[model samples]
Target: MAISDVPPADCPPWLVPVHTLLLGIGVLCWDATYILMTRRALATKSYGMPLLALAVNLSWEMVYVFYVCEAVLETTGFFVWLLLDIGLVYTTIRFGPHDWKDSSPWVGRNIGCILGLLTAVGCVGHYTFAVWWLAEPGRGIGGDKRGKWWQGREGLDTTELAFWSAGLSQLNLSAGSVAMLLVRGHSGGTGYAIWFFRTMGTLFGLILDNAFMWWYWPAGYGFIVSPFAVFIWGTSMACDIVYPFLLWQVRRTELLLPDGRLVRCDSQPASTASSDHGKKKR
Candidate 1:
């Protein structure tokens, strides 16, 4: 936002801050939506869903914060978002049990078991594809002279690899949110607003990660055939294109209640939705 933050003409200096700031805003907007939804779930004590997004997103932020992004804005933004992920993870842990209490008593009784397992899976999934984590000398282990540990991975594309995780998460976010609306019905754990922010966040990311980089980085970093970058960029573009239409569907559909039940916004009152929920419970 400041004049000093601007980069040289040959390169897009402004992009770094823009990308990082948008990331932070997107994380907050996302988690804030979860917070609202979690509160509603807790208040109603209805059902709780799995924590796929929470685990995956938290893992991505961890990789970026510790191993990927190291600049001032980038680092600070990632750290802040990492903290928010913790909050979301906490919320999920708190209210996510009711989903399987009766259906799967063992899991509901000890949901932490699932979170621990997912965390391990998430860590491995992120590290497996993350380039810098495997190639950075003295970055992974305490004693390591040779940085390249794996074959065919010595010349890994860090930027694109980072976005692979990012892009997939974004796509997961778009698809999963639509599924969530169906599952939650009027359950109130999310809203169209969350999707709006999410969609905008990807647009901001594309501006820097794809558009700016395509124009600027070719002159400097050279055009690396990064599968990760290509994958994420393609996914981001695809998801961004579908987001608006999906958002429209959400608005056009029946109204939702705090507990995820459907109601007629024009004909039925809030009390009627509650009555419907009660009938379903019976």
Candidate 2:
């Protein structure tokens, strides 16, 4: 059965439309963010997602598509995301080393292998967590049928599972984006478009979606307002909000090369700049 077939038992019929709308906005925006990131990464020849964040995200999607999610719609969404994530992964494997060349040449040299190892580990870790969580009777149910688990015709609380997993993923993505921006000192694969879509996606997907769910179905979603969830999403939101301004400042001192490299224009001499640019192009 599908999510549409089983709205949480406690959710009033009138409320389902709003809940669906909120959820849809979140999902759509997140998909847009993925598209933008992929496009930007290709255009800039830079990996848009942070290495560890992508590893965690890809693993989560892989596990959900394979074992956790059962509904047609949810599974389809996860599958689509997994495909997009593969695109991001390709860009990272292709261009990620360029970003790390100066500061961490060893990492730059072996980025592909390192990412492979991390993703494998992430898949095992996520799968094991899912197995442990679902094996428990009441834990998967999240208290009672009238609670959030009713959203699924099946007893498994895929919603709750997604909540925790996706929350951590969002945190890592947001935090990593900030760190990546500062570490690179230039906007290469990232830009205002990515930032807007990512922030709005998180707002709709994680923040607003959970808030709306808790407002209507408190029993199952009370964790939404709890300290930890608050801290996770809240911190992510702050980082996302702060990123674009930093991007603006960085752009003032950075130049985008025709070949898709970003270089420092403010600190170096024109002769040195020309030489460095030529070498980077080569």
Candidate 3:
């Protein structure tokens, strides 16, 4: 597609005025809260799972920024998505688990490693495909009129890899949610609430994303289905907005240790000895 096929360079004329307004409001809220939390004195203290939520928010923000930039989106939209996936994997690796002994730590770490590998492979594949598309824009996999460049065969492969990575990430989130649910009695109520919201929003986002990917299958219809494209894009942006807000809420109410240290809770069941001691003390 010619560059002109994309919306105007200044402000995509095609985007509805409401989309712009909502996106602006969302960005404002996200940036203000993020800045406030980062500058708060307690920021130096441990934020528990809130930190991971923030990381997820920031990763989506990166994707949004790239999407808004016409130059970047036109030149490297596929690669930009792949890069965002890599960043997401890195963030999951860095802050997913609250404690080393938690089962979620192992699950999250392994999933992050796998996602990282897939993203790396996707990056290479996308780059290679971009080179080939540039060399022969007319050549296509099937005899489609849109041409090979628009077909996004390479991008499709990368997106497929991303789909699996996202699926694994969802599983990791589910494991974390289960761990939180099982240990809800021990954690602060606010923390559990944050997890609930984060997990629910993420789950919804994944489901919608899966639907979008599925709809584009058989012959890839995203370009033809404008409404579907908008739905996927909008849902992604919504996920970005919700994640940081949940993190801010969690950070605001974290419990502290008696000695002013941050208390890290584990998900493991209590030993029988501990249970007996607690019963006797009670």
Candidate 4:
């Protein structure tokens, strides 16, 4: 039988705990990210993540929980994230309209339907990709036993699947975050905590995890260290790194409206205007 047909080799006893530890850190970091996002969303009455990025992330988790993931811990992690995503989605639908009220009334009005449609489409798109990728001959089947569990079975390469899909997801998230910050020009629905947790999540989950995997199983995980993977994660890291500085600049110009909306002031510095407005009210 070809190597692909052969049963996966056993995981090294020592590596099992190490594997769990690495993935565990990643999971915790991402879970914290979701929690912080939800909290910030509620506080500002607006959504934190980009709409398209959220849809893709929710769909990715749904697929892994039902169709892709094999390990118990992995499935559990995806499922937990899914539950948190549901809350985040609710926040988006509930408060997203207020943010879009002035710019695009129609979008604010039809936000729920748009998100439903996007989620459905994302599900179909992600599932189709997984089906084709896992079915291809000799694809995604070269790793160790843990590879079979954490990565893929037979030709079902969860790791590579996650890399491409999650890589695209991260790109959308990181780039969209910057775009949102600039477009909004205020600290609405976002904060330093969200950025920090999200950045650390990517660091642990994608960059560090892949690096460790390659160190442990160089031959099996060569694709992870390849140029393509590097580019995807590297671009995301660069975007994340630049986010805080931009946020600082934007915060300086922000004005807190009486109705709890945070907006930018281009005509004058926010501190001067805020103080003047306070004096007038007094």
Best by lDDT: 2
Tell me how far the alpha carbon of residue 22 in candidate 2 is from the true structure, in angstroms, after superposition. 1.8
Location of the lowest summed lDDT over 10 successive residues in candidate 3: 141-150
Give the candidate order by descending lDDT.
2, 4, 1, 3
RMSD of 4: 4.8
In order of appearance, the predictions have TM-scores of 0.62, 0.88, 0.35, 0.85
Off by over 4 Å in 2: 1-10, 140-155, 266-282
Model 1, TM vs. native? 0.62
- Taken over the whole model, the C-alpha lDDT of each candidate is 0.52, 0.76, 0.36, 0.74
Model 1: ten consecutive residues of lowest lDDT: 140-149
Q: Model 3, 1-282: lDDT tens per residue?
A: 222122223433543333334323433332333233223213323223232332333343343233322334333543433343343334334444443335455645565564445545544543454345445433333322231122343222222223333433344444443344334323322233344444444433344433433343323323323454445444544544454454444334443443232333332236532453222110
lDDT by residue (123-185, candidate 4, tens digit) is 999899988877754465355433333233444445667777788789889999999999888
Model 2, residue 169: C-alpha shift (Å): 0.6
* Predicted candidate 1 versus true structure: per-residue lDDT over 1-282, tens digit per residue: 111122335555566555456546555555555545455455544322336666677677777677655456656766876765554566566655654444476776677678777767887788776764545433321221221222333323444445557766666665665565555443334445554555656665533434554454443222223555556556656755665565455446555454554432443465765575423310
Residue 141, candidate 3: C-alpha displacement in angstroms: 19
Which candidate, 1 or 4, has the higher lDDT? Answer: 4
Query: Which structure among the candidates has the greatest TM-score?
Result: 2
Rate residue 156 of model 2 by lDDT. Answer: 51
N/CA/C clash count, model 3? 0
| lDDT digits (tens) for residues 1-282 of candidate 2 | 115424565678766567657777877887888888888888888888999999999998999898887767778888988877877888898997877877898999999999999989989988998887676445632344333342343455556667788888899999999998887777777888889988988888777866776687766566677778889998999999899888887777776665767765553447756775522311
- Higher-scoring candidate on TM-score, 1 or 4: 4
